[model samples]
Target: MINGSTNEFIDRISTCQDTVFIYKGKKYWFQGYMPNENTVHMEIFQIDPAKEGYVWEYNGSSITEGQEEFQIAPIFDGKTFWEVEQEMEWVDC
Candidate 1:
């Protein structure tokens, strides 16, 4: 069951789709949604000191990292971290 705030958040992200946004000069993209819990996940890429990818689950209040340990990890199996990192592209608005 989704909460009102979560529903609104989902509506807003749907309009942007795959667009990436900059935060503190780093790139991030919305990866997927957890409908049961009304949580949204995002991918944060590391570009300096070698490239890497990190997953953060945003639950309206605070954001946390560690996608592999997330309940939705299995959904993204076979998707190597590097693969996601390489696929990242910057988008305005």
Candidate 2:
């Protein structure tokens, strides 16, 4: 249910698969997804600030720190996010 702004996010979700996202130069790893009205809440893997990117699912977004509580969070993890999107029938091939 993501809009155009999320297309690149979606694309990487399919193609890259393993590329991590770095937000505020921090890691926002792959945690899970949630139910949003139009866009499903992309739950980023919570970062511990004490760990690095390769350890957990922690791929952060260039997205700002406070952005997490904003109106939108990107499809955080590419691979699984796309899988969930496909399962939810949000995007078409």
Candidate 3:
């Protein structure tokens, strides 16, 4: 997952086309934007050990969509990376 703020995630994806994020130990790559839906598309992939070089096997895609604030929603999990981070901070208290 993104280690920074929601804005940071937006900035990274906006500026870099190759930006990827790790969630639940799996890597996801940005596919493109869905202007009609006002959401970004991301595809999940798994590293193929059988490959000689860096190869990714298509796993699936992110089911969540971007919020009005540009924060990508978590799939049925009810928690975004930012929310998880916030909870972590509370646990430390």
Give me the candidate number with maximum TM-score.
3
**Best candidate per lDDT, number?**
1
Write candidate 3's Cα lDDT for 35-71 as tens digits: 3444444432332222143222112222232222224
On a 0 to 100 scale, what is the lDDT of residue 59 in model 1?
42
Scored by lDDT, model 3 comes in at 0.38
- Candidate 1 residues lying further than 4 Å off, grouped into runs, are 1-10, 14-16, 33-51, 58-91
Per-residue accuracy of model 2 over 1-93 as CA lDDT, tens digit each: 332234655554433233334443444444322233333322334353645333322233322322332223334343333344333322222
Q: Stretches of candidate 2 above 4 Å error?
A: 1-6, 11-19, 33-42, 48-93
Model 1 whole-model lDDT (C-alpha atoms):
0.39
Q: At residue 62, what lDDT does model 2 achieve?
A: 25
Local distance difference test, per candidate?
A: 0.39, 0.36, 0.38
Per-residue lDDT for 1-93 in model 1, tens only? 112243333344443244343333455555544445545454434433334555444443122332333323422334533333333333433
TM-score of each: 0.30, 0.27, 0.37
State in Å the error of residue 63, model 3.
18
Of 1 and 2, the candidate ranking higher by lDDT: 1
